[model samples]
Target: MRYSVSEWTKSGSPWVWLNAGAVAICVIMVVGLLGLIAMRGLAHFWPADVMQATYTQGDQSRRIMGELVQQEMVPAEQLRGAGIQVPDGVEEMRRDLLKVGNRDFSSADFVWAMDQGISDKTLPEMIMVAERLEWGNFYGYLREVRESGETVARHDGHAKSPEYLAVWDEFQRRIDRVLEIRDQILTIEKHEIGSINYELERLRLEERSLELEQSTDAEAYAEIEARRAELNADYEVLQQDLIDLYTKINRDSFTAEIADGREVEIDIAKVVRAFLPNKMGTGEKMAHYGVKLWEFLSDEPREANTEGGIFPAIFGTVMMVILMSVLVTPFGVIAAVYLREYATQGFITRLIRIAVNNLAGVPSIVYGVFGLGFFVYFLGGSIDDLFFPEAKPAPTFGTGGLMWASITLALLTVPVVIVATEEGLARIPRSVREGSLALGATKFETLMKVVLPMASPAMMTGVILAIARAAGEVAPLMLVGVVKLAPSLPLDGNYPFLHLDQKFMHLGFHIYDVGFQSPNVEAARPLVYATAFLLVVVIALLNFSAIAIRNHLREKYKALEM
Candidate 1:
């Protein structure tokens, strides 16, 4: 039987339907947003066929070679306004953004061309796309391979010629050799020499500390000098090794014929990978895509974070959130326990609850400013002055760093934890406490054994919320610690293992820097989306871990609640 609208409202069915509808809409929007991000971001890794075409504008016909990045229909008026001569009868025109990525040879990495002017478009098997260490991708044909300034192999005009295949084979072998050498150089510099440098710095600091303390220890000075000598010897050896590796890596060079029919010599050291998209089989393409995706996740960023992977940013974001959770949970729980269990329900307590609620509403940037001022400058400076006087003139803790950023986020998210924990505490049946007390248990023991165990799921819920918020936060991190690029990870093989005093990268900040601060907006656009999707995934992973714990806790304490 159909109910009247008033009757349905009276029965609360309308409100239920409304609430369900709202929830459904929210879920749909969120899924759609994630889908859009995934589509735009993930497609960047796939190898698209590079097109060779003649682009004619007015009287000048030029050869254009690049991947077709985006296509859009634009009003003829807009095209004409941009000084392009649109045909008179055309009301709208299709424009294609081609990623013509010989950045060193071209004025732009990406150029928009009217579809009408694009002629003789073909996916030529000979077209090679060279992913580079700098200046972006190079779309060209491999013309010659040179070793130590001597011509090793030269490509003929024919694509399938034996000479061309031999040249390609030689190029691949040289690339493999260069890559192996590059890895050795990186290892020597980043780890082996890095350790030596770290020890040398520590020695210097020790020497300074002794000087500050007015120590006359002759043996100490001698020891420091001997250590310094050893380090210098190690550095020299590594330096020589580095020189050799560089010489080897820079030995091979290749000449490529770009779209404009100009031959440019590119050192093998600068080329990251070279692939012919048109010639690649499906399996090869898949393998290439896998490697690219892995690099995006595992490698260090290059070219102002517009290219390369965001591993550092990912590491920093996760580390900060973990630290924030650890710092916030106990303090928040203690505060909540004192408020809900120990304190008298009076005006003062009410005032505190009000204050805690209000703290949640404060602007995140305000938290950032406060963190920069108090946590970074004031507290950190005081610590540095007292404990690290030897490292004077150079502020150690008195700067934006991992520890300060973590603490700042802890403070920012504490209110959420406190409120959630207090609610959890309030939900416990008083009889449970009374029963434990009646059985000769102390208030603390009863609270710990019975009440807390039952309330842990709520505490975890709070922690989950805190993690969700802290992980995605970028503004406060910018002030407190996050940098555009961190040369080294805060956590590494160095002594103490974790260097909380070091500034670190965050995915949110990476996205911001790539999306807005990048010099190449077109190049960075897909990266921004990809990074955003990864950020979401990271946050979800953190939240899911907390949720899993919460679920376990809930299960463990289900009987008591019943």
Candidate 2:
């Protein structure tokens, strides 16, 4: 009744080919997706040329200047559907998306211009693009530079003028000096003044504590007052220095002729970088691209999370994952060791394993809710009451923070660690355990010195798995420590260095915030892609590091386990 061998071969070969084709197709799709993401994300930093064009729609005509971001073709009906008129016999139309910055003046940072409406498109050699600190990007023609209400240099609508070059050089020099002064101001404000404030708060708390203890010694109060006065004098001096620096930074200003023919004045200190991308040669553009990339990586976010870097988010994500691994490994391993090596092999143990497996599949939000109520409110409140009673009502640990976030994720991923470690322990030969016992070694010694070392690779596998799950987790972190914008990092130069109670930023939440919650969607889109790509890269790097260590351990213990 069975099929002949020839028939079976024909059928089996077809199925094998079909399976291979499916695998190949999947690989292609995955590669294409990653390539698209990388292309879109990395292009955000490239210096794009500025285009000056005349745009006309119906009876309206105006000149527009900006970066030509993209071009596309669409059916004429689509244009008409949007209330735009299509010429007779036109079946399709071309449109361009322009990044018309100068958000302060323009209603939108980006606009779509139909090919039928645009005329006299030209890449202007003199058009300048200014990356600003507050108003997104500014695209216009450089007019002149001013200092203290007097004209220092005027462009005269000339690109090769000595006056223009002089002004540009002076502007560059002033920008360097302004940046230096700005750094000084930040250091004074954030670190110097910050330390003084912390000391003052500690003193106030000390005074409160003394009052609570009924120790109202006049000499103690006088000493505290004297110290406070010294700190106040130091703060006052730093504040005056900051004021002087700000005045110096604001001394120089530049005028730009916008697309509407109106000249606008912008303070030099407000500009992050100003460059004529249209005029830049290959080398210049490459250099500019490098600078922009570095800035994107190193700087802090500005303009509603639409501009600048994501350094804080990157730091937070990595730190949280590391902390989670540190907290999860020992507990997960110990639990697995006890269950597999010590506990009676029975129905209850099997039921416990099933429960652990179910915990892994439970929704992450459930974990967040549990962490919020149990860790943040119950346990954290208790700890705060006991250790940090002085900072009461302020809720030091009694709110979402780094420690709770890390622990929550550890709890979420612990099941995977336990399962992996248990599987590993089961793989070891039974005779190995019995041999150690027969050789007069204690069970603990055998497990620690021999069994655990052999199981190290599997333990690492568990950690790697835990990290992968924990690093990309956003829903739970939203209720835990992650914020749209953290004012300061959890780890800083302040006392204790590692501030577990402080809130932190995460790249996942950053992508979500910029992509979905940003006020300037167009400006935030590129950043979303860039941040997503960076997050993927970070997770990959962390996993690869763990994998490398796991491989080394596996190699080290291969012979012993065999």
Candidate 3:
């Protein structure tokens, strides 16, 4: 009554194993793809350091300015002491008294000191800039320079003030600082180096002329030598002062310069003034200059591709889909033609049917490899020789671009069209074909005038399916046309504008580059998700267009009955 081990195994059968294998594969593929896409496309928005930086530039006062915290808040008593009349507003006038306790009065530069991107969450701080380093906002700069006990003018932010000429007078002070003119003529001894070379040269020439005139007296010669020695000693000491001046050149001496047709300078003090969020103009630069904390969630592409009109990737994908559709349609319809019209149901026809169906069941990626090897290298190379001899060695039709990408995708999706067209051809009633032949129509005419017209809708359905598959395919195009960046589009303003030979950008490739291939992974995530969504929408649009065209073709043949 017991069964043998061999008999038990045979009773279980192979179909069970096949079905289980198919389900397992489907689950693994779907789960793996979704996981990979989400992990790369939704994690982080911005880099870390930008979120934490306070002062992006330096703080210097001599040539630069800090925030004007307390410029001109002279009291009425002080004005009266200086014999100046106070304005009518008196104490009611706005004061530059930026105090520490009150949170309402704010300067423009405090929010900039935070250096973070837009946040609706917390209230920002107000910081006052001090005229000297010690008085400036504590965290506004990386470091500060303490001022010397020298006279300095401050702006009152008002139109009528004696210190209004301070900015212009700064250059004058710099000129005087350079010479220290008073230091040279100590008791007409002139032993300091204060632009005294001119006086020394004049005296030297005078002594030489005196020597040439008459028998130069010993007393006169001694007097001339003594005066020349004093000037020489003065020039020598001035040379030492010039050496000291070089050591003091920090941000204090930075001067505005003009160069060949460009303004190539940056004022650090101006940047600090512009840093406060309240002062910025409403533009993109204001959104993220240094860094934004939300970059971790931002979906921006790497480099942002500011050049206004280069959408090469989108163009390439569309071009490839069109080319693939054109190539696959004819081959699929013709093969269906041979099978239905001419190929008799012999052993060879059955074997061909079996082979065609088997090809449809084969994995699409395998077709991609076959296309790369056969169409790109063998058939493509052959055509390049016979028709495109000028582009030798390079193999014009065989390299990566719109042409090869299209051809490769066509080969990959051809089986789908073939199967679909065969179904359409099979759906035709035998009576219709017989009647066409009875009416003295040729078999080819019956196909051209009747059979194909009747089957156009079904034929279109296959095209729609092929396009949908090709539009979202990133792997096959990776081998054929997808590149990280293309300087120019495949189509542009030139002779025969559609340049199929150029490498193309693709949304799929963009997703890969932004999510996986980028230098800053966290900063590109949101952009990657948005891009992925765009790719999905694009594929749907293509399918919808194909469906519309198919419906039109179907309507054109509605009266032709099978």
Candidate 4:
């Protein structure tokens, strides 16, 4: 009853099964990868109990305290090769990765401790984890809370001590106040006084422009000076306000005992957050997790992007893709329309179609090189020289920036749009065009009114494909406009809010930086997973929006279809 290969092919059942299996495999792989990323990334925000343990090595014992990161069993041969003594009968040695914070005091923030050598492990309910602004986290016992060198709340690291609760309440209040004042200072520095500084610079540039033109009239000079005076006055007031706020913030301090029995005084202003994870209930832990997750999403990164939120990267990535979409759509649609509708059927047109297809196959790095050479250097340099000569020797548009990145991505993805759009235009019925012409509509009107409306869904399809490609591109962005860290966002409250020439961060570049470029690879690993998950979500959202528009257009033009 066995069938021949030709008979099986003729039946088509084998091919159909093959296709279904392939699709299932592909889907499973995608889901598995995403699940792994989520497990690693999202677990970083959860509050884990601090283990205060005694770690012994070579006849020396030291107190070690931090989060238990991971555990593994390693072959005895491996440990012996690394100069560690192992028992003769033991086949393997157990090791635990401990996140021993206080990087400032220790050589490393994370270390591997042999389970055989470690003893006296305890989870102390009074142990506190202080997330600081620098040097990563600090794990210790809260000692004394002070204000202006006067003891306010003192604790002896006892679970039944009321002083610990008082200290916690007072510290929480001060932290809230510090955060409020910090925001005020940031607003003034980055926006209020920032606006003044920007205006002053603009005035200086204007004066220089006038001087270059040999038109530095007395009246014009006086007007510029007047504006400068106003800006300076505003800056003085803001400077005083900052000084007062700084004084207020530094007035509170606390002392905490580290794992090694030394108490260190920490300024309240330096503490980003303080939490007692061992004392928290399930509901409290969940609430804390939610807050931490929110902070990761909304706060600007600190400590080399291993800490804080990735809002800037998220914003920059979305902004760049939107700009790329805006630039690619019209150019691709117009080129496609000409090729499909207006151009005579000829060899040259066919060659253009071939070239467009070939462009899609080119490596993204090649596009990056072209963008760097032609867009950033050649075209942008010429623009800066012609229009921004007053700021010579300092590049304005003649450097990697947001606009150049968008344009580079648009150039890279235009081929997809053109191909999709041409296919869409080809699907239109010949009678639809003839009918519009018969009704006295010009060729342009027919394209604008009848043909394009029916082709709207296709344009959106092209845009979706373009966005999908552009959002994930990291190599070209690195060469053109993406940076390790941008001090300011491209869009801010400054005058002429959208500054196209400013450099920006991107999620793709951020992932590369954190995963590969970070000094603390262990600390940064979870962030890599989290950032990757977020990037996938962003791409999905962008595609969904385009798909929604395409669906609407398809329904509207259903009557026009043949």
TM-score of each: 0.98, 0.96, 0.50, 0.96
lDDT string for model 1 (136-220, tens) is: 9989899899988899999857266788878888888888888899899999999999999899999999999999999999999
Model 1: CA > 4 A from native: 1-5
Write the residue-wise lDDT of candidate 3 on 1-562 in tens digits.
Answer: 9988788678886668888999999999977876666544433211111111122223311111122123244566765575544566674222331122111122322222111111232212211121111122212211111124232433323232345344324533543443343223321232233225545655665565565566457887787779888877766775666545443322232122111111122222211111222223446334543333233222222244211112455666777888889999999889888887788989998898888888766776776677678767887778876766544566567676777788778877777888898899898889999999999999889889889988888888989888888888888777776788875567754435676766788877777877787653433455576567556667888889988988898778776651
Name the top lDDT candidate. 1
Worst 10 residues of 1 by lDDT: 156-165
554 in model 2: Cα distance from truth in Å? 0.7
User: Which ten residues in a row are the worst by lDDT in model 4?
Assistant: 154-163
Each prediction's whole-model lDDT (CA): 0.93, 0.90, 0.56, 0.92
Error of 4 at 225 (Å): 0.9
Off by over 4 Å in 3: 1-310, 380-395
- Give lDDT: candidate 1, residue 116: 93
lDDT of 2: 0.90
- Which residue pairs collide in model 2, if any? none
Q: How accurate locally is residue 562 in candidate 2, as Cα lDDT from 0 to 100?
A: 72
Clashes found in each candidate (C-alpha, N, C closer than 3 A): 0, 0, 11, 0
* Model 4 lDDT per residue over 492-519, tens place: 8777899999999999999999999999
- What order do you get sorting by TM-score, best first? 1, 4, 2, 3
Residue-level error in angstroms, candidate 4, position 271: 0.8
